[model samples]
Target: MQHQAFLDLRTTLDLLKANGELSEVSGEVNWDVELGAVTREVLRRRGPALLFSNITGYRGPQARCSRLATGLFASFRRISLMLGFDQQPSNRALIEYVLKKNATLVPPVLVEDGPVHENVLTGDAVDLFAFPAPRWHHLDGGRYIGTMGCVVTRDPQTRQVNVGLYRSMIVDRNRMGTLIVSSQGWGGHWGKYREMKRPMPVAFVFGWDPVMEFVAGSPIPATICEYDVMGGYRGAPVPLVKCRTVELEVPAAAELVVEGTISDDPATYAPEGPFGEYTGHVSEIATPRPVVKVSAITHRDRPIFRGTLEGSLPGASGENSYMSSIQRAAIACNVLRNAGIPGILDVFVHPVNNGTTVIVQIKKHYEGQPKQIAAALWGSNASSHRYKFVVVVDDDIDPGDYEAVDWAINYRVDPGSDDIVVFRSTFGSALDPSTLLEHRQLSELGAGLWNRMLIDATRTWRFPRRPQWGGERFPPLVTPRPQDLELVRKRWREYGFAGWKAEF
Candidate 1:
């Protein structure tokens, strides 16, 4: 079967509709908390994508012209469809597939015109509140307009553009505040601008091609441009068009683009968040962050606003963190493979675990190999500092299977004997609530310091019961014999078992 490119938000929605994966809510909805409530319910149910045609509150052109969409990439089936896959594969399979396909780089193509320029608001006419930006959670400080969006910025020295998925909260008609962790790429860019005492030009894209959303949220290497990885996913260059006010460029078919400049002055900082974050917890405290002064608001006529429920609810659905975990796993796997780590079979990063806690499956060839693998993972860029737990298992154990992993940890691991390496006061995720401000230690990069643990769950020795039973002679797993299991699997359907298919 031939596949189609999910080039733009409209195209992706159309595909979803055609596949009966989209749900339309035509009744009038409020932007304050009603929309978020509904979106939360839908996501909790693992329901279809929502397209709200009518929005209440605003009485201008935006009321009639703007719409809202949520749950765009909420399910495995939706993700598979977006990636142009023939069948919905297991999470591990999908990650491996994406890693392999993304190997081929495809640069973006510049375009003169696109649908995003159908209507443009520049200079004094720019208004950040033109659309129905949802107050996603009741406890959120304000309506966030850039939850499912990408913040585009360029480095001052390198001039290399970095597209990051930072939540932007609308503060006023022409200003918005966005969180920038000191360790993130955008933070690095802003840090340079702060050092230079110059405002950093930024473009916030609310609705663009679905591929852009995925790439923006991905942990792409700082050296490789996100657009290039986006192109690789699309199997072609992502079409781009120059922004109206900013020096940056945006996806040509973007639904809404907010061009602005992030003030570098510390005095310009605004109280940013008390918002319910992806960690599924509302930070009791808010912090002062740089605010973006909108210079332009460009979009297609009758544009749709895309939003995501970022807090704990989506995490419970198991859909929210899937992509991030997959991408992080791929990065970890690549790091290990490139370092000449042998017998590496698979890698799975637990999604709900704050994108930390990586599980590695490897073929055990020698003693102390699992410890080496764990150490390599801990030292690598993909896992170092970021990942909190590293668990190494044998190839037979599926990394994606938590139950299997648990069994391996319980049986193969000895807390005292097996290596459980711990590195103290290392850089860690700021979102980790465990790192209290009072007890927090800061790295030079401003990352919070925390301890990381590595568990070597892989079999370390063959039969230690006897010296004669040595070398590649480990006791076999207690289960049905391979040939016996195969025979039973092959004829299971003939035995008249219900829902017993060969593949399952």
Candidate 2:
């Protein structure tokens, strides 16, 4: 069982293709809307990861970067592959793996040079449109180049670095419009810079090991740098190179790197979004957002531009959803552990909502355990946009089974009793469509307000135990005895059910 990281995007793509998990398009596709539509359609069909080699206006010999790769981590099978698992691992297995890795810290090592510096463009040579920046949605404000890119920043006082996934739209040839909420990882760095009245140096890293994206997008502790966690995933020191124009370091093998600075000055603000977010809906309309003024652009020789469609649909999703399913659940469980809350057996996040709702299976330890779970999850910085709905079930229930969770909710949860809990006006995702526009205004509120809900699906312990209840607070479920089930299993073949297998 050797688990290692795919050091570069090329190797990762090759492995995906060899595994029959990636599909390449040789035909030319328009970058305007066609490319995004194709990617979305593939996700809808649960098809292979995509590689568009022939995009319109990007096929000429002089093209800087022609190929585009998206949806590489859109499925559990692909994600398992990224984690070095030959066969698709179970959800529980992946969650446990992520939990351990998230806690491990292997600091990155500095490298004087690498592939990212093969070509460096500064001042007039830098062009944001040189690579294909897809207009993922027709209603989108503009082409977003940093949808899946990692944004690197550092705290002014402690100088503790943070790598986060923040959306960026091409504002001009050397400027990008971005929505930086004060509640996010990078937002905290921006605030420290703001207090100092100094522009924040920033770098955007694209296309390296997918582990960079995996760790950067997660809600790891503020004290631990994501590069360290990424190193833990790789089982080696992550080699990083200093950015030309920023005080941050990026993966040495990253396909492309953009270095720049962001200031709070109104002059640096530009009209930014209405982007199709991971919430499956467009957020606030185009508004003045802090913009990154590019001072330098660096890349590998004939770099492969990496980008992904951001929105998640009913039957379709992308890398963010798949990655979050494991990361969010593990992070939540870690939060519970830190709070000293016991009885947590399993945590599950359905890809559809990307952890907006979570299900936790636990052994009943106390009457108010469900409330404790909700409080601990909400209190954590990781819950800024997650764990909005927490459902706690008994050990007998499986969190992954929606029907089982639903049944538990219906039978065990009494709406008017303490079984249901709601935490109002808590910090949450500004992009949640359900959140009122006024609540999402970043200018006023630092974060969105969510009325969080907790459905205690476990059986109530307040009831007195009777002779028929077998000394238990709650009545026993109407299930066949273990010996009775064994008898049925043995006689199932003799009872004219030879073709069917009894799994229970």
Candidate 3:
């Protein structure tokens, strides 16, 4: 029988704490840019997840920045812990588990009077500045209150639930300026509201289970409800509580929830940007954006605020911190599977940039057939619109094993013939340096349509050698005389091989 699911984020954190992966910090961390930078460095260095107890500049009688799960996926061991997976499991194995659960989605259960409703603020009493809104970078426009928040929405027409991870900037003590991409469903909702000349209803929830948080930020199929996906992720149904002011449901044990309405005036632009982006570069342009008016705020006592710094590629936060490429990879894999690609090892969309570069590995079947697989990959829906650079290799060439992939690329492919470039495709990445606003002045008009190269990096059939080399058949399958590995294990103590760690 499956184990009973965790009740909430606190329960999950307790499990993590018992496992020695979470560290409680009493450090009086400044909630300004300092905390953001420090937390990022800690995650980058592969330290334990931190729970900052004291946050400066917040006048509330409760704690701030109390919980954070960082570096949970930086190592194999931690990823295993997060997924309840065995240590030796490959990425493919983990993804298979994820997919299986995704298909068995259980809708969230509703409950009343959970931890998130312990405190309530409405109308004039709602002061977002009371919380420690972190000024993540030096050049940022202002403090951001919702870098870790998930915006919940339902399609006006279809009523299908959608959750988007958008950065919410604190425009004042009560107003939040939000930026969302048009490619996502949140953008679709905003468009619908504009067409009807109505304010867009939105609710932002923070401090939920890490798996639920990740699901909210993932690229789940448009047909899949994000809430149901979160339930699938946890291996059980999620428990939810209705919001006080908005007609939306949030995780029952969430630390905080803010309900609001999004403005739709084109002329009501703000001087946004100059914040550090995932490309590891500071942005220069200032653009108008939707301003969110907070009608109510509700939370658990001693709420936690989570912050992620944004910067250029491979810099500090942003792409790497947000795990955006993980979403891209998941989506790509799903597409590949639907296309009947067999023995897929893994799909990795490198961070710091958007889905520009995609690396995939699959177990090759038959001979001279890897190119057929590579061609399908080049034109696949997932790879076509976004990825500008794609590399296909065999399972022996692990996509994560960069050194081996580079070796395959060096050995295969005469660049002129092996590299195929397709042109005039839609490409819109906020972190991409080449991406610019189109002639319509609409940010969604998207300016980065150009050629994309898909390279056949697997071993080629062409020969400086035989018709078959390094394949399943080489030397009539020469077999090594077997010495019992079990015998060695039994005799290791006598051979002074007691050096192996006994912890396992």
Q: Best-fitting candidate, measured by lDDT?
A: 2
Best by TM-score: 2
Give TM-scores for every candidate, taking all chains together and pairing residue i with residue i.
0.89, 0.96, 0.82
Clashes of each: 0, 0, 7
Q: After superposition, how far is residue 199 of candidate 2 from its true place, in Å?
A: 0.6
Give the per-residue lDDT digits (tens) of candidate 3, residues 1-504.
133354455665675677787777666667677877876687566576666666675534554334443344343444456556535365556556656655668787888768888888898889888777778776777887776788898777788888877777887877888776555668777778878898888999877776765666666666778888878766677788888877888887887889988878766546555566655666545577777888899988777665556553354334243354555566677767777867767887655444667788877664444445445554553442356677788677778667978877876666866444344454344445565534223365533344556676765545345446444222222333246666665675677535564421
Q: lDDT by residue for model 2 over 418-488, one digit each (tens)? A: 88888899898899999888788887887788899999999998778788788887788889999999998
Better of 2 and 3 by lDDT: 2
TM-score of decoy 1: 0.89
- What alpha-carbon RMSD in Å does predicted model 2 have with respect to the real structure? 1.9
Error of 3 at 121 (Å): 0.9
Model 1: ten consecutive residues of lowest lDDT = 437-446
Question: Per-residue lDDT for 1-504 in model 1, tens only?
Answer: 245564688888888898988998988888888888888788777789899877786545636255788887777788788788667887768777778755656888899998999988877777777888888788999988888879889999998888888888888889998777666778789889989988999998977778787778866767777888888876788888999888999998899998999986768888777777777777535677779989988898888888887765433543446566767787778777877878888888776664577888988778777767766766654552356888999888999899999988998877886557787776666666777854432223365566888888887664455444433445566689889999988887678868665553
Clashes of 1: 0
How far residue 73's Cα lies from its native spot in candidate 3, in Å, is: 5.2
Q: Is candidate 1 or candidate 2 better by TM-score?
A: 2
